[model samples]
Target: MPTTEITHALLAPGESELIEVAGNRIRIIVANPTLLVCDYSAAPHFPGPPLHVHPGFDETYIVLEGRLEVTVAEERRELAPSAAAYVSGSVPHTFDNPGAERARFLSICSPGGFEDFFRAMATGDREAIVGVSERFGYEAVKTRG
Candidate 1:
């Protein structure tokens, strides 16, 4: 195994680097080998990423403002302010903003590197996004209409 460096990160609101993907803005708060933290903002009625499974990392979402509909596996629930949800690795999950106002939240992934995947998708190329997601052990599942 290789050694990894651990560094400290301090980001005030609007200070982190923001990347846009599929109409959502994601600010990378931390992107180290052990953990990845991101501040996400989505427009109203935004359908988030496709239902996907991460085979190498667990993800947790902390809702900061507005409401979000989070679906894990086959279950779904609405989260309000200050609410949180956790999805373990290999679980299919996705989230969406169902409120009329913009939604903001913190998304944390363990055993970090998901930020890189998001960055690749920021280019808005479908093929590139799929390739990067596959490289990161992410599998997208087909959702029902």
Candidate 2:
């Protein structure tokens, strides 16, 4: 059997690549071909992107502080600290910070690389975000007639 290389990272506090889009903050903790982890903080009325889906990636969101309102397809819930939600690649999902306090959460994406999108988001260009999102197979949900 052949040996496979492993990827690893050790980032000190405040050492991650931080990106702020709109009023939310995304700190990229680690990004590799197999995994992408980010620490995200959102203010109330989050202004999250539209319900979207990643055709080639699986994502998980875990709340660390305050309250988060997560919607996965037709299911919606308010999650408190320590709560988590798993979203399949093809599912339409989005989230918001419904409470008055800032909400902190972790976002883990498999087949890692949404970091590129976050980086583009830092440019504060909607067109760039759309382009990058498309390149990564992450897009807004389509409506059915």
Candidate 3:
């Protein structure tokens, strides 16, 4: 649920809400009406989500450590630390860690509300995840380029 009262939020290290999804540790740093920010670390060569889109919001992936392979439509790029990728909500996209070392990154979603998807994903229930995805306009595409 989106916070009814938007306020400042600060997450120190492990203080955030941490959820393990798809073998990745995702810490939700901030979630409010206007933005949602999460910090996550992906295991080496971890395959990310299938090509997907969240039509309700735009997203940005900012690499904090190691390299993250990001694909937006047909274009793929391996981004190093401090590198970032901005993806429009209508674009089909995905990300993974292609390097041998673990990769850390921040995922920022504007007009926040998608954190519920992560929470639902933490339950490891496919049906629930699908419902939440549908509710949030998050959809995995079969063919996108």
Which prediction has the highest lDDT against the true structure? Answer: 3
TM-score of each: 0.88, 0.88, 0.89
lDDT of candidate 2 over 89-132, digit per residue (tens): 79998888867789999999998877888887778778877886
Task: Please give the TM-score that candidate 1 achieves against the real structure.
Answer: 0.88
Tens digits of per-residue lDDT for model 1 on 1-145? Answer: 8876676877788788899876788999988888988989988899887898888899999999999999998999999889999999688999999778989999999988778777777776788767767766887787734
Check candidate 3 and list the clashing pairs.
none
How far is 89's C-alpha from truth in model 1 (Å)?
2.3
Give lDDT: candidate 2, residue 134: 80
Relative to the true structure, candidate 2 reaches a TM of 0.88
Question: Cα RMSD to native, each candidate?
Answer: 2.1, 3.7, 2.3
Candidate 1's C-alpha runs over 4 A off are: 1-4, 125-128
Better of 1 and 3 by TM-score: 3
Structure candidate 1, residue pairs in collision: none
Give Cα-based local distance difference scores for all models: 0.86, 0.85, 0.87
Candidate 1 Cα deviation (angstroms), residue 13? 3.6
